[model samples]
Target: MAAWLGWQIESNWADPFVFAIYSLVKPLAGALILVFMYAVIAKDGLHSPLFPGVFVGNALFIYVPAVLAGISWTIIDDREHYGMLKYVYTAPVNVFAYLIGRGVAKAIVATVAVVIMLLLGTLALGVPVRLAGINWLFVAATLVLGSAMLSLFGILLGGVTMITARHNYGVGEAVAGGLYLLCGVVFPLDTLPAWLAATGRVIPISYWLEAFRRALLGHGTEAFASLSDGVLLAVIAGSTAVLAVLAVLGFRLAERRARAKGLLDMQTMY
Candidate 1:
């Protein structure tokens, strides 16, 4: 029911044709920006060996902003926009599950955007992707682990947002930008400064993307080429487990604090 509510909220904004076009056009425009940047920087343009990894990485990175901002925004939207958060809290629904369900809606849209970008890259931009060549199992595992980790992060952010007296939607966007640079979405981590690269190494999303890249292209950046598939998967799973505990604890504490302070129903007009 929560998922259904989320889907309705997301999809009911426009007619199917308009929504579909918005989905395609937004991702397409974003991809074109990267394509133009690659063209200018790489002498070989789209034909360069680095193009596929960069293209695929950019294509998949959309989920970061979608899931993170989507879930966190639910708290702000319900409280500030609709002024029903207090009611929502009193309702007999699991708030955590509702937030996750909202994030799931964003994930569903992100998946469609990803598919459109991949199809465009393969057919027109010459990304050299073949559906028959993909490792479906690995991709599935990576997607699940990565999405779960990201959703936890979103929940943590939402919990924090609940206590904030001021608007902080930019927090999610800031985190997404940080992840884009730190997770090697468009460039290899090794190319970063030594300290920065080390920081990237510890992030689960870095390993997740490396695993995902290998799944799609049968190879990934040399930065993680030394790690076997098992090791990569292990890192992702272990980090996600750790993050799950933290997100739960943090959110519960935030909930308690929000209740004690009577901030759940507070609204910042801005």
Candidate 2:
């Protein structure tokens, strides 16, 4: 799985340098868009206090969709593009474990993307990141815990796509996009409608992002102050545990259905 993921990244471009550049450029562009949007709205250039919030939000936001699409698309890639589903299905190795490996690879990629965004925001865009004031221990804890939760969520999405939209990779993309909006990536959850804000409360990303910002920025925002740090961590950890179990169950069900319907190797008009 590690070798396959390495090949996946390397095969994307002709040169290793180009691939590295592409990875940095893509996330940088995403971070810049939100930063500049905030600048425009505030009419105060990039020096607003809100810069850190937007910066951290966009930087971390890249992981949510990237992880989901990475794991879910690998399913489409193997089953549809490479026509290797039959081989994969018949393998003695556990399929859930295979999916977890793919998710880990994607999580590593997302970590690099986050680093690139942080560098770009601080070095290029002049977004203030007070490195000296950051609580490195808490930040590290938030990142590790948050990544695990997001990866498990990705595995769950992969299982759902396998059962419902095996041939359509766009389903993965669409689900990620929806989560981006509903997860409060760019804006505060309060900005959303009452129902949407309520919905965001249940999603782990909301708590994860809030805890992330508090750890990195050294201050908690009002949006997430109702929950203590312990509570936030508990939610993230508890949700991840629950999602891991669901992902395993979901994969089993999806596998059974695919086999029963003869859809494991079936190619459809996607």
Candidate 3:
């Protein structure tokens, strides 16, 4: 029900056709920035061996901002925009489940954006992802495990937003931007300083992206090129398991604080 509500709210702004067009355009515009950057520096341009990984990486990264910020945005949207959060508390629905549902709704939308990006990247940009060469299992596992990890991260951020002020709308996006820099989205982590490379290695999304690239393009970036596909999947699953515990515990504490301080129903006019 929460997922249904979230979809309705997200799609109500435009009709289906227009919404689909908007979705396709938004990601492409972002990709063009990377395309132009590569064109300027690479002698091989879009045909370079490295271009496929870069193209697929940036294309697949739509989920990070969409899912990560989308769930956190729910807290701000319901409490500040609709002012219906207090009613949500009074209702019988479980808050954790509701947030998960909301995150799933965003993931569904992100999936559409991802498919569109991948298709366009293949046909228009020559990303070189042949269907016969792709690993469906890796793609499926990465999407499921990666989305779950991101949802937990989103819930953790939503918990923080539950207690913060209305002006804190940018919190989730800031975190997503930080991850973009640290997670080897468009470039290899090896390009960064040693300390930053170490930090990126610890992040689960780093492994997730590596696996995703290999699934689509038959290989990944040089950052984790030494590890086999199985090792990368293992790291993603293990890290997500650890994140699940922390997200749940942190959200509970944040909820307790919000309820005790009367922040759930409190609205700042900012």
Candidate 4:
């Protein structure tokens, strides 16, 4: 199936040393900068409404570590890990605006990061980026949608983290850390293990990747491998859209309940 889908990995490991560093350093550094930004914000004022901004903004490069780090910082504090959740929910602003702002910021950043990474991959890493089958339009569209979906997942997790007794932050971190790899950011999904691939089907990011590859990288992306394939790009995109809407509703409902019960006033303890 990998061969059929034209899944070939071109290695540049032995390439010019400086180029390799340049290729990897930017994203790593960018990711670190994000972590630092969040850390400073968290330290400066954990109670500020800044977390939603920090949480959504750093997602630009899909650095789950940075994202989770911000998440951890946003929730955990000196006295209590879940400090800011209470105050942020009390603010009078339209919560969706905050959510949308974060999403837009992250999407723009991720798109720019994608451009920078591609340039680094080609110029610095010595990676061959075939322009064949690259559909700039659809790729752009899907990427926007994909980033939005990922942001929604972040929000959903953040909200759920607040109410749940289980400190699944560790598990959530592990899962987020593997998002890019599991979703085939640097590798092809076709190369995923049988079970992993099966699970990948349910993740909207995977379908977006498969479709994005087909639209941009080239044809035979395995996204439209089978017309009858249950996990079609259309289906994944639609499902994620629904999830995004539902997440917004869930946030509203949570806020209302938190206000009514005064849970919003109590300090959250991990």
Which of the two, 2 or 3, has more lDDT?
3
1-270 per-residue lDDT for model 1 (tens digits):
766777888889899999888877887898899899888988999898888998899898888888987888888888888898899889998888999998888888899999889989999999878889999999999999999989998998998888886647677778888999999888878889999999999888889888888999889999999899989999999999999999999999999999999988887787
Order of candidate numbers by lDDT, starting with the best:
3, 1, 2, 4
Q: Cα lDDT of all candidates, in order?
A: 0.88, 0.75, 0.88, 0.50
- TM-score of model number 2: 0.91
Q: Lowest-scoring 10 consecutive residues by lDDT in candidate 3?
A: 46-55
Which ranges of candidate 3 are over 4 A from the true structure? none
TM-score of every prediction relative to native? 0.96, 0.91, 0.96, 0.60
TM-score of 4: 0.60
Q: After superposing candidate 1, which stretches have Cα over 4 Å from the reference? A: none
Locate the minimum summed-lDDT window of 10 residues in model 1: 165-174
Deviation (Å) of 24 in candidate 2: 2.0
Clashing pairs in 1: none
Q: What would the per-residue lDDT of candidate 2 be over residues 166-203, giving only the tens digit for each residue?
A: 33677767877877787777777788898998888888
- Per candidate, the number of residue pairs that clash is 0, 0, 0, 3
Q: Cα RMSD to native, each candidate?
A: 1.2, 2.1, 1.2, 15.4
Worst 10 residues of 4 by lDDT: 2-11
Q: Candidates 3 and 4: which is better by lDDT?
A: 3
How do the residues 1-270 of candidate 3 rate in per-residue lDDT, one tens digit apiece?
999999888888999999888777888899898888888888888877778888888888899989889998899899988999888889999987888888777888888888888998899889988999999998999989998999999988998999999557889989988889999898878888999999999989889999999999998888898899999989999999999999899989988999999998777888
